[model samples]
Target: MAEVQQNTGGDGKKGQQKKMQIRVDFTPMVDMNMLLITFFMLCTTMIKSQTLTIALPSNEKVDNVENMSQASEDDAVTIILDAKRKAGSMEVDTVNGKVVPVVYYYFGKPGGPEGLGDAPETIAARNNLQESEFLGNDEKSGKARGIREIIQQRNKDVLTEINKLKEKYASGGFGSLETKEGREKAQLAYDEAASKVRKDENLKKPVIIIKSTPQASFGSLVSVLDEMQINSISKYQIDNMTKADSVMVIDYQNRHHK
Candidate 1:
């Protein structure tokens, strides 16, 4: 509510004009603001923070030989992350103020059936470590390149089944994707089918092992894990780098970079 008061000076001259004053009462407005704040606080829904779930390695050390034997060497894929080295130096290299990431991968046991031996000559000779980049995909063809291509190739079987399930869902095989309720039900069914495909014992799937050098950036590690999810890889774990892995990487760098 607002009030106006007109004041006329008692002994003023005849030509003197009256003055008016205005005063506004804001108590109601303050109360209304408090009510609005309370209403919003009670009715508004808070967004839950999202996080990615990743499987971390066990604290207890396990023998690599026994681990490899459990899952066939053919199905094992080891991806190593390293910081790019400067020319003719062991220092980390950066591009445009960012550390350049280098990817190295080896299939099966390190150094094949014989394993990585103590001798430097033997390590150099048996080094199966291959270098790759984090190049995501080709823009025109939408084809995966670099490390992504290797992972997709190994997980093609599961992906094939998943793709089929997608086709069925899109064609209303699961249910009608038209209505809201229908879309929800169809999505649930699609998820269940995809889960079955991933867990099917008959499907041939690769077990990926991720390792990183001391100098590798956290962003690079996250990128590799993103690839695992993008490729629909179910069996993947973060593992510590071994001495043999160090030797092989060193030998490979020495041979090629020199």
Candidate 2:
């Protein structure tokens, strides 16, 4: 009985020892979980996407134009006002060395020298004479008449063309002031001129550059802007010196020629 008691105690002690042994093997499992997380992170390149590149201008010290006298003509639209008529003309000269004319057409007059009459009846008379005399039996005459018809179809066409240019420039795109119809009409007008049609390659719209003398009233400048705004050119750069860099710059030295 004593021997049996000793064997039973020995078995109990062995069981107790077995129970005390720590058998937790979490190291391999932890390693596997870490590997899985790292693998997924490396494979997930979708988190990185392409981004747009834009050049940002620096706010460094640059050559500054103190006033209208220091402003450059290259940065302005030069306007020469002919005192003979109360009306003024505009020209667009860009910083990139491009110059274009901002041509204006009278509301009722056909856009040409011959159409420069005091009244609509005079314009009609001029058209009649051109149709009967210079353009007699010629295909050119027929084309000219067609162009006139297009201009006369609606005054809004000209305004629409001007609006298109304004929108283009406002959206950072270059816009031509001349429309296909306007150019065609201008061509017909030139043909009717007494002298050879001196084609103005420089004439365009939207970014009209002009120069007005100091004697010119502020109302004249406002008038030009009004015309542009009416045609939907809401944004414009005036050719003058201002406190803001975004505003137009004027050059007194360049104004000597006009």
Candidate 3:
């Protein structure tokens, strides 16, 4: 509510002035401001979440050999993601302030010639589980470290060409980098060049098969996928883990926890 008080200024033969004092109650205004602030807080978009798109093969059993594309042992890399678990239990293990992700990788196949073997003893012998972490780019060289470095090494042929394309994009070779539209055009050109690099027949590339345990965090899955994009990997798929995968993980943890 607002009110105005009138006061007489001065009196003269033929001139007089009147003054007005306005009193405004700010209680309602404060309430209105709070409501507006909350409204915007609820409506505004904060951090945009990133997602991965994966295509799964049909559930139907395929009996034809000619239709299947088989990857040779030399070209396959199997990556397994698991959460840090208790010593010998299935409990979620965390260290510091974050959920630690344990990575296991093998050059080819789940198990060697004797494929997971028959018992836990043989499984441990055949288990190729190795531990790694999700680390960021190096401070000085800006080169990716940790598992990223390992992946980049395997996909060096593809990434070598992609890096050239990235350089070209940054230098404004595709279009002017000053404007948004030009940036978009440049990005499209870079993507096409990167795709061509991935499809190059002369270069050798590894086909990655990513498997995750149920206890693995979604953030870790995204981190691994980010490595694929950063390295310009062409062929990769998210697959369900098998019994051998579980046995290997548990056995490795049990042996190491001691």
Candidate 4:
């Protein structure tokens, strides 16, 4: 708001000029600005930051060797990450200046039923390493491909239970999903139930052991771990590649590439 003040001429002089002053009130404008800021703060929605959560290995020591938990041979699955190699050499192969990743996996053991013996002939004959790709879902069918398909098949039991839980949650078995508060509560309950199913002793879940070659990119390792999470796997660990693992890989490349 603005107001004008006029002063009368001095001593009633005919030629004297009148003086004027203007005043503005900004308090109302300040109050309106404060209200606008408050309205935006209350009505605006904030975006949540997306992140990948991974469980790290514990540093606690065990007193007894027998007390250590081990995966059963029937349920063990080993995945090896490696870079693509040239036709007959150890040189890494690249496509469009990007290192191509290779995935290998085996069930039960590295050298199949007989195990990896020191003899070269035995390794050549019994090596169970099978190559695969990091293919995603097929566009037309929406079905998983390559390594993702393998993990999903091995983790069928846990995934089946998780799917059942999803159905139950959608049907309001855990809680109502109508309101924001109700949705949050329902999600918490669903997560707890899924965790229990993953850890259940009766369920037949595969224990995955991830290994990587020295030339393998860190990105490849992360990709394999992503598969574990996407497939709802609970029993998995990152481990060092053994001598036998190296032998099998070299022997495989030699036989196949040549």
Any residue pairs clashing in model 3, and if so which? Answer: none
Model 4 global lDDT (CA atoms, 0 to 1): 0.86
Best by lDDT: 1
Local distance difference test scores for all models: 0.88, 0.34, 0.79, 0.86
Local accuracy of candidate 2 as per-residue lDDT tens digits, 135-198: 1123654442221232223323344454454464445344332677655555454334312211
Worst 10 residues of 1 by lDDT: 63-72
RMSD of each: 6.5, 22.6, 3.8, 6.8
Clash count, predicted structure 3: 0
Number of clashes found in candidate 1: 0
Estimate the TM-score for candidate 2: 0.21
Deviating ranges (above 4 Å) for candidate 1: 1-50, 62-72
TM-score of each: 0.77, 0.21, 0.78, 0.75
| Rank list by lDDT | 1, 4, 3, 2
Per-candidate total of colliding backbone pairs: 0, 8, 0, 0
